[model samples]
Target: MAALFADPLHDQFGTWPVAYIPYGGADFGEIAAVAAEVGNGDDDAYHAAWIAAAERLEAEAETTLASGHESSARELYLRASVFYATSYHPLFGAPVDRRLLDAYRRQIAAFNRGLALGPHPVRPQRIPFESQAMPAYFMPAAGYETEVRPLIILNNGYDSTSIDMYFLSAVAASRRGYHSLLFEGPGQGEMLYEHGIPLRPDWEAVIGAVVDFALAHPLVDPSRIALSGTSLGGHLAPRAASVERRIAALIADPGTWSIADGFRHAFAAMFKLPPEAVADLGKLDESVMQRAEQAVRADRSMHWKVIQRGYWVHGVDNLRDYLASAELYALAGRAEQIRCPTLITQAENDPAAADAETFFAALRCPKTFMRFQANEGADGHCEMRNRSLFNRRAFDWLDEQFNVEMR
Candidate 1:
């Protein structure tokens, strides 16, 4: 019943609807509508059905707002924002596409409108990052504003947008007395589209900016701040904590040591070399690179999403360079250097299970390596299919670690 790609809506629908439902970003009817209209793996199909649903919901939201039904309007606008965010899932390789840009703008607009009507108004804030203003949201617990509270900076992964962070993580944290700061950093969400900032491997700079933003707020208890990331963030968060000493703890929801490990398998298969050999060589031949690109483009499953999305955000189109860059994103000599308490989650069905293992073995800090079973419905990447259970357990660990006093 809780299958990863069971939706049949997307070839790469691995845990998508399942992942988003708990956050109220997805529903059976809307998911089914898109599946019925758009064939999986086609970028154009995703854009059409999902955008239409978003536009329809947005019109309804505007109508409700005009009629003074602020509460209803807020919910509708949130739904519209989520739908708009979903529409451009497959159109990767830079946010330069007009249709994709429009969807992103709508997502932001709807989210902002909904936030304006909320009891605790979410500030549309920005963090300073090398002459660019990184977009963010500072959300405190519903009634805990101006109170000194433990803070959790929610970092999104490779393709997760600002909308996904709010529903899936920030609100969850706020519900549990933790103030949350949700940001769209380079290579993620609106940052890549609105600004042309690609991701940088020195993730400490990103984490540093987020921590700076969090501390600047009045509600933040600087001593109790924990930095955590999901998906690819499972790798980036730990990397950042290795250097950023200000954060008290780090959480990698599904620990990953080296992103390059993902492409090593692909390299071994394509070039008929040992995975270790590919890792050691660190680069590929031009002929092999061409063949790799063809294979990725021809793929009709999750491979297409992973490869194409990686190309755009990584700012590289050539297969060899893209895959090799993954190798550079490893904690080769830094995993042992993380000085704070760390919580690492590993899902049974994710390739990162192996990543968690390799990453955990190198830890020298106070670390907790936790696992998610397939039977628990938390087996997908980042365990988004069952975020509440994951969040409950994760936050419990955080509470204990920080000695948080719950209201």
Candidate 2:
């Protein structure tokens, strides 16, 4: 877990793809090479380095596929997709940079091509939602491609695409004899980037559509369907599960109490504000908002997280509205409504897991809290450093809850 790049922001984002190594999403040497190429580089340099790696892997995938080595081609294409996905984080802001758009498109293409050649049965889907459709993929469990099998629907948080979800959860779930559905909801992937959709607090409506899709599928076992959300999805999935009773089991990776809660406490600690002053962040006065904006803009990490990525995802034009919009994502009264068997995970060093205990304590369902430690190499956000361990424990719990025989 040592720093991968001198730039803190780069170090954090750069290490994400490493977690995908177990599923052929990357090789540590390739990632290390890219990191060395981008040492102390600015946003553009970071973008250029990753883009170069992605293109190289993509061309290799094409040549390998042409020679009919599908398995090798699958690995190369999937690896390329992860690199392309990693390349655009620094470029995430309004007036979407042309480079970001192009990289994202290539990322999707590589991921889909890889999926077509994978061992499992995969289908690209367009799940019906309000007016626009959410892009999704239904991957039937490897050996149960023609049978009714329990389904694990994977949801990603803040910045990950549906492709990231596949390496993070879907592939693992399929190997365990569980069908998988991975989708991009509002404010994510193509939903936001291609269709102009922004984030929404009412995720129940969004997930309700996903459940409908699963129910309609001949291979998915509706009665045993499970939902797992990671990162910001930690909150979104629970919020939806609260109302979507069809979800028989739930997993929130590093459970979050709310979107604004973390920011509120961080602000209070940073500026020494009294509890009451930072209590209702949504209603902070204009001057206070200006001060917060100034504080965020002063740091490169905070600038991208709050001003650029935050504003764009929330469909807001100013810091105040973004904070106001975040207020809608709270799970205070909502967590108690989730009735399914639930599992919440906490990673030792993940700042987002600060509220995992609070979220776990509030849950009234049959719930379990799983904690990952730094010594286990699974302490980062979402246990990105050692997801093989995370996935094993998570699905084992699901299997127990659903009375599933071990595979």
Candidate 3:
């Protein structure tokens, strides 16, 4: 048996059934039926039940996280991450609370123990991304002692934690013998919360560093590297790929052609601040305390504006300038320069879908576009919560394109 601390699902016990047990306020029958299905060990049923539970947990966690109950939020997030991992039978995504100094120490200790214990056969090995001598977790898999497997590097969109968020996709790729890498870059889940690195506009540099790191690793198949970015990363990934010719394939889901729109929307909604105040704050080189003071006074919706301003301070320039330079909007002229096969997926309801399609149409390389309807459960954003049925279709299309069947 895996050690209790070593097992990602250990603390997640009983949550699965709880996930399906609808609270009085929630719709009951659907959750109950899902619970029953998962209890029966049917993979499809389990997944459906888990997804429903995950949706509920995410809502609660968001509330907790926003309320400053970091510990409570961490527990719920752990539950959510484990649920995703268990569905695919991977061992990763254990929660760690860094809010308290003691808890942070323990969490780091646990992480060290877990890493030493190693991963499941199908789970990618955890690699370290050293920044300023501090180690961050990364999952990397590559073709070894065989023909190089196509490398696929995945980046999470806004609010996603670690690669543990995409355990299902990672498992799918591993099953297909494709090497996969999942990293927590700046402004990503744990990285942002733990290290305060925030997001950067020059994603190409970040990814290029990762690619270079991967190439140096013995298991990575250097020539077949690919990039898959979800949500905001959808825009970031292609931008990186445009600069890094080493990437042979690119898949962007519900592309973010511009960050300006997302920034404005988030700033207005998250901090409750007017756009002008946010613009004004952008001019100042202020301390975090000052930034926080201005944020709390302005409006709650403007919290995101503060964050956006921080993004600008970190060399993104203004939001408009950043958006203007995004790959989705600007890569069209250079799309022909990419020699890799590409796949772009979009959701009808997604605000970014139009830009994704625009990018797709302009691609000079071999490419395909898949559209998902808005009413579908998993059709939001990058289809992150979509069912296996949707993913099966995507994988089949990819297989056909890559001729994996014959290989």
Candidate 4:
């Protein structure tokens, strides 16, 4: 399986173009090597390789952007996005960079262009749900231009940038012929920084707006639209699908029953602070809290602060308030309201979802649960590091649900 999915680029674009020869294949080679080295206990080496590739891609992106070659820049950015995704999480238990602002800025710009050049004729504008406008990048299939093919809206999990949608998952859907839209809403990626729209408990409204937009578009198959969320999105997507009956399918990886718990863990990891301190700090004024989040994202030690602020954005005043949100439990209660087929993917050793089995048991729907071993190499939260494996499983299941015949 590892050999089959060895090259991330292969799974995505199916081989780099010869036009990339100028780079001496450094970027593509580094990516493949890093993927091979990641889980073999050579985490530090993997991290170094991943970072070097990202830096190279970034430089290439700068040149492309400066030349006013939007198309080229977009592709370069797409490659860079994959590199960043690999490096974003430092393995060997190292601290995250406190100041990734510059890298993130470049990433957002690159992804924006990528999305702009790649448009699904049916749904052209990929707008955000919040009042502040942010673009959602989506692609529509060739033949299903008239029918309402089930629209699958993809959301990233905690600490994920929407750019990953382009390099990580969007390509798979494009290949599989699914009308898919990928976006960062609220506490996610650019939406949190560019727009003041923080995370909300009722993600249904966010997805609801997306669904409405898809249905209004000339090409979307409204009735067959589905919601797919990764990482924390696992929680957010299900919450939204429970309320929005129009969504025909709900697919989540690493099921979540509490956003508060998610925040607690993230804050603790990012800031290297105790959960109590993080929770206490969250009670401060909204402006103060936002600054803390920015500070944390900039400073590795303060990373926990970023996680805490994320919780506060979702209406948690403190740890107690967070625990009380009952957002996940309530969403679970409403799962029966979902009128579509559902898919839940869980990691066997994921600490975040220690109670995943229990949570899965509570879900009431036409659902399929897949358990992946931690050693499987694609078992991380939302399987961010393993795009090929994630796509193989997700698209395969989606095809079965849609009754799509294999080509």
Query: Per-model C-alpha lDDT, please?
Result: 0.79, 0.90, 0.52, 0.59
Give the lDDT of residue 115 in candidate 4: 49
Candidate 1 per-residue C-alpha lDDT over 1-407 given as tens digits, one digit per residue, 9 for 90 to 100: 43222234353542354566766666766776766666443567667877888888889989988998988888888888888887776666653788888889989999998888857667698899887889988888766877989999888888888788888888788888898888989998877887777777899999998898888888899999999888888888889999999989899987888877766776688779765566543466667666666776777544545566777888876666677667678987999989899998888888865778788889999999899988997776777668788888999999998998876
Superposed model 1: Cα runs more than 4 Å off? 1-17, 39-41, 280-282
Model 2 clash pairs are none
Ranking by TM-score: 2, 1, 4, 3
Sliding window of 10 residues with minimal summed lDDT for model 2: 115-124
lDDT of 2 at 79: 90
Q: After superposition, how far is residue 47 of candidate 1 from its true place, in Å?
A: 1.5
lDDT of 4 by residue, 1-407 (tens): 23312334222221221112222222445545555555343334554555566667768877877888766766666666555444534320112243344456655554454445433322225564546655576666545534455567887776565555544556566667777787777766666544445566778877877777777767676666768887777788888887888887778777776654555555567557665654643353455445545655576433333334434344444433444443333354665566578887877556656556655677777888877766766554555435567678888888887776433
* Candidate 3 lDDT score at position 373: 72
- What is the C-alpha RMSD, rounded to one decimal, of candidate 4? 8.8
C-alpha-based local distance difference test score of model 2: 0.90
Q: Compared with the true structure, what per-residue lDDT tens digits does model 3 show for residues 318-366?
A: 4333333332234545555656788788876677566776778777788
Alpha-carbon lDDT of model 1 = 0.79
lDDT of 2 by residue, 1-407 (tens): 78888789988889998888998888888889999999889999999999999999999999999998999998898899999999989888887888988999999998888888866635578999989989999987877788888999998899999988999998899889898899999999998888778999999999999999999999888799999999999999999999999999999997988899878988888778898988788787667777888999998989999888999999998888899899899999999999999999999989999999999999999999999999999998999999999999999999998887644
